[model samples]
Target: MSEEVGRTAQSGWEVGVSRTLPYSGARLWEFLLGREGVEVWLGAGVELPRERGEAYETANGITGEIRSFHEGTRVRLTWRPKDWDHDSTLQLTVVGQGRRSTLKFHQEWLADAAERAEQRAYWKDVTERVAAALAER
Candidate 1:
């Protein structure tokens, strides 16, 4: 992996994906941020806390803590991998569209070239899976 040189080194990688969820922005945020709801979609046994700074853990061991939330609009969390940078944050944006909503994903802090490339695919898959699961419900 090529290490980023310079101040931009800290900026990290940012990838975004959009999906249509059959729920409103408020409903979408509730499901993504809820413990049971997260487990049903984000991951198994996922524990997502509503309070900022609170950590969300899952059975697969992916843990993310709340960094910030904007009611039914956006939610930002620092997803910490045991072996990766703890500063990484995944920002999720929810856009209301009539009775449904558009979900946008922004995964930042993915630096290491090798890891970034892998995650570029992983995040896309994750978002697609989420959309499919939501579509089924």
Candidate 2:
């Protein structure tokens, strides 16, 4: 599911998407944090450290800094496409037990309603792709 909260001007807007997958949190976390796993959904290679304040770049030209990291559970980062004027904050939370998992993703600090809507659609598609990839694994 997906949702958007608050006005774009007041708090930069917030967009969230969630998905349930047939994988463990550790598995999903690897996909989200590991370079090989990122390539599956993002269509790019990412160079990132698992520590705060480290820079990361994707082959698709997206760049950001790691804001926070909690191994096998959560990651927060600053995300900016090559064309965006500024960066946005994105947080990914994984909750899972055994072989089932739920991923909650939030991206805030968007520029406007348009950007929020755009990202909502973008993430929905991306997360769906992620789910499909996990299923194949």
Best by lDDT: 2
Provide the global lDDT of candidate 2 against the true structure: 0.81
What's the TM for model 2? Answer: 0.87
lDDT: worst 10-residue window of model 1: 3-12
Give a tens-digit lDDT track for model 1, residues 32-61. 666645664457776666689887776776
Writing each residue's lDDT as its tens digit, candidate 2 over 1-137 gives 45545455545777998998888888898887676666754448775568899988888888898899888888888889899999999888899878988988889988878988998898898888788877776
Give candidate 2 regions above 4 Å deviation: 1-5, 8-10, 40-43
For each candidate in turn, give its C-alpha RMSD to the true structure in angstroms: 3.9, 3.7
TM-scores of all candidate predictions against the true structure = 0.75, 0.87
